[model samples]
Target: MTFARHCVFDGSSVGSEEWCASLDEKDKGDWSANEAADYAKYCVF
Candidate 1:
């Protein structure tokens, strides 16, 4: 996903509730912000 794709998602990281909630606060935010595209590529189908 590129910046345009990320913007399409409106900055919200979509994923399993358990997985998202399991992350530490700071780590989660960073992961969501910095690696959202890569994360989605690997984590999602």
Candidate 2:
């Protein structure tokens, strides 16, 4: 997804338990700032 698209959901890197916890849990390690778009697609899981 592009910056404009992903920005709609969450403009920046989603941390803590503020947004989708499922997506955070999906990542076994640090969620790459570059991988935010991939996480939005649920492909990272």
lDDT of 2 by residue, 3-45 (tens): 7566555634453233456566666466676557655664433
Weakest 10 consecutive residues of candidate 2 by summed lDDT: 11-20
**Candidate 1 TM-score to native:** 0.28
Candidate 1 regions with alpha-carbon error over 4 angstroms = 1-26, 32-34
Off by over 4 Å in 2: 1-23, 26-29, 43-45
Which candidate achieves the best TM-score against the true structure? 1
Candidate 1 accuracy as lDDT? 0.51
Report the number of clashing residue pairs per model: 0, 0
Query: Model 2: clashing residue pairs?
Result: none
Tell me model 2's lDDT, rounded to 2 decimals.
Answer: 0.54
lDDT of each: 0.51, 0.54
If candidate 1 were superposed on the true structure by all CA atoms, what would the RMSD be? 10.4
